[model samples]
Target: MIEATNLAYRIEKDSMGERQIPETAYYGIQTLRATENFPISGIKPLPTYIDACVLIKKATAIANSELGCIPQEIANAIVQAADEVLAGALRDQFVVDIYQAGAGTSHHMNVNEVLANRALEIIGDSKGNYQKISPNDHVNYGQSTNDVIPTAIRIGGLLAIGKTLNPALASAIATLTTKADEFQDIIKSGRTHLQDAVPVRLGDTFGAWAQILSEHQQRIQTAATDLTKLGLGGSAAGTGMNTHPQYRQRVAEILAQLINQPLQPAPNMMAAMQSMAPFVNVSSAIRNLAQDCVKISHDLRLMDSGPKTGFKEIQLPPVQPGSSIMPGKYNPVMAEMTSMVCFQVMGYDSAIALAAQAGQLELNVMMPLIAYNLIHSIEILGNTLSALTRQCILGITANSDRCLAYAEGSLALVTALNPHIGYLNAANVAKESLATGKSLRQIVLEQQLMSEEQLAKVLDLEKMSTVNG
Candidate 1:
């Protein structure tokens, strides 16, 4: 039972929080009071943020082990405490409210206190009794919030990319590949600028999707690689003032082993500490992906227009009535969802961009926002891809009849005759066919453009489509 003394905070505003879970996690003020005290980002802690916690834990273990920076007993306690966290424990006790200012000082302190409590628990003790393992002297040895928070962020971004975002991308790429293969034989009037220009197989268009996603996957992979370069051991502005010489590489090697990913020190600690450029590059790729998704959604909406007045070449599945009042109608729900997801990813990217740009001197002032936004991008992308595969890509089926009919009716078929008869003649025949409501065959035969042999030789739809293949 701790009282709120001069914790550098005194609440003056009404609070907003509900008590759904047990109050065992926090014994101080109500959640409402705590929230009113520290109001940063409204985001709760996600497992994506666990990388930071893990790094802090491992760093603490190293700091005491090699440097003899703190007492051996305290170091052992911190290690045992961190092991509890790694083994799935004490997640809630570290609940520092998200809004606390001072460059994530609350978060750092929360972690320290939680580890200290768990360390105490390991030796059969109660929480907050830091005597056995002082949170600062043991848990947070040889590090500051600057180093720990940033390191954790890098680890989280990399992990989210590897585990969630990468798989979603792979699935999306696979789906696109399948669509490209399926649509390969389907030739339609390919449009440029909302107007029909030439013939292209539907498969070719889908292939572009596959290839585009593949490109994004490449960029994402590259970005992931860049992110592997970390800023650990650069305690307090890259000078390593209080840290031992071997601390950086040793702890980093341990982290690499623990996370099963290659993590190395930044080649230039000064550059890394002063610049958020890597995140900027990554956020740019994320923005590109969002833009690509938006374009794809728009294309889908255009392709699967109306059954009565629009393109009608493709019919999207009718999942529900498009309008509440209208009985027979369908809307592009999947496409709209894709668009919304793209909008969200784009927004997150923008947040990252702004945050990255704000870095000055030795650190960026917006670390919390940076973590929140980048994580948002990763989560939105992961869920969006899942939705895309289940609701849109997998749900789609080609309208063979309509696709063929549109191909057959289009005057763009004049392309087949362009080789033998020339463009002007084909254009005239198309104009006559439209004028008299006659088929291209009727106009050709009546005007004596070519006989059966000549027409058959030149007007092969299969051959014409194969050129664009």
Candidate 2:
């Protein structure tokens, strides 16, 4: 260790070369090299991922000590250090970039080094004293990056979906459901291929949106179940070469206790190590959800298009000024934002799918990319859904008069005369209404195709909008 002017450097070496790490950093040489090498994304790994890694370390320490694989003193110190991390300490210590070494070796080593150094401090030893508690020999006693990285990603992803995304989705669903009920009686002109169609209840449209999201929420929860099957004890090549026979089971139990989720070991370690299909499944579900979000946001944008020149059938809450030059102009900022997020999530799903397919025979080298993209999708979509619910969906106001006017004036209203007059006659009425710029009811009444009482019954907008048994 060398003390320079205002900056202290600790010398650390690996097979590649020697590097000086900051004396205050819990991370060591491997993490230093990773930061130097991968500056691609300019974003660090998420703190939730770090938390999952630390929890794995703590569980590993407890499991190893219980199995007599490490001394009690060392295990106790490591657990204490990892506990500090779990409590949100030393967050900046995990400094590796989101884009880093294959299989996330740099990330695994970064956590190991941090835990090792903190354990040293707990044992009254200075930092960088690998002799007292080596990152590999003690902190990573029975694990390999191949197993740890994927397991950590799964753990982190599941927690995020459960704690954040699921609730956000539920809130969105609730808001849409409420809107559906509120708009149940508001009949509007429905469009197909951007052309006027028969009338539909605005509530039915909102209910359909809610149903789509509810299905997505269920799919996400189901896919997350597969994440709980972990590949923890499969060392470098999924052979469990160095770990004890009971290490995997013991670690799963400890992890279940720690996270309050019942994690279990994979039935076949080799299959688990070589395949990332579970993650791909979850990503596919997220992609489906993103697709739905894009549709809903686009629909909202179209419905709220203009106060003067566009549909203007519904009004979104004005959250911000949409333009710099236009006065009193409020855009559908939340809907646009949600659409952009959904597009990004779709891109991430593609990346995740490609990464999942690139796995080789023994181990997948694209775990780091998978972890980064999966967690990012979950976090951003969660936040976006929450914002869409509160800032946009919940505050939407229907232009009932506009909706009624559109419904009353639409040529499609001629369809109601089909049962009474006939399809050909109704078609003529629609064509004549369009040609003369007269309403369908006006054309029918002027032509005397039906009596006034019969026309009123045939043109009952509310009954036309209602679903027939």
Top lDDT model: 2
lDDT per residue (tens digit) for residues 126-198 in model 2: 8888888989999999899999998998899987897789999999999999999999999999998999888
RMSD of each: 5.2, 2.0
Candidate 1 structure, TM-score to reference:
0.85
How many clashing pairs per prediction, in order? 5, 0
CA lDDT for candidate 1: 0.71
Q: Which stretches of candidate 1 lie over 4 Å from their true place?
A: 1-23, 26-37, 71-73, 86-88, 93-102, 315-323, 328-330, 416-419, 425-436, 444-452, 467-469
The global C-alpha lDDT for each of the candidates, from Candidate 1 onward, is 0.71, 0.91
In model 2, residue pairs whose N, Cα or C atoms come closer than 3 Å (at least 3 residues apart or on different chains), thus clashing, are: none
Q: Which candidate is the best by TM-score?
A: 2
Q: Which residue pairs overlap in candidate 1's backbone? A: 39-99, 40-99, 52-152, 183-203, 184-203
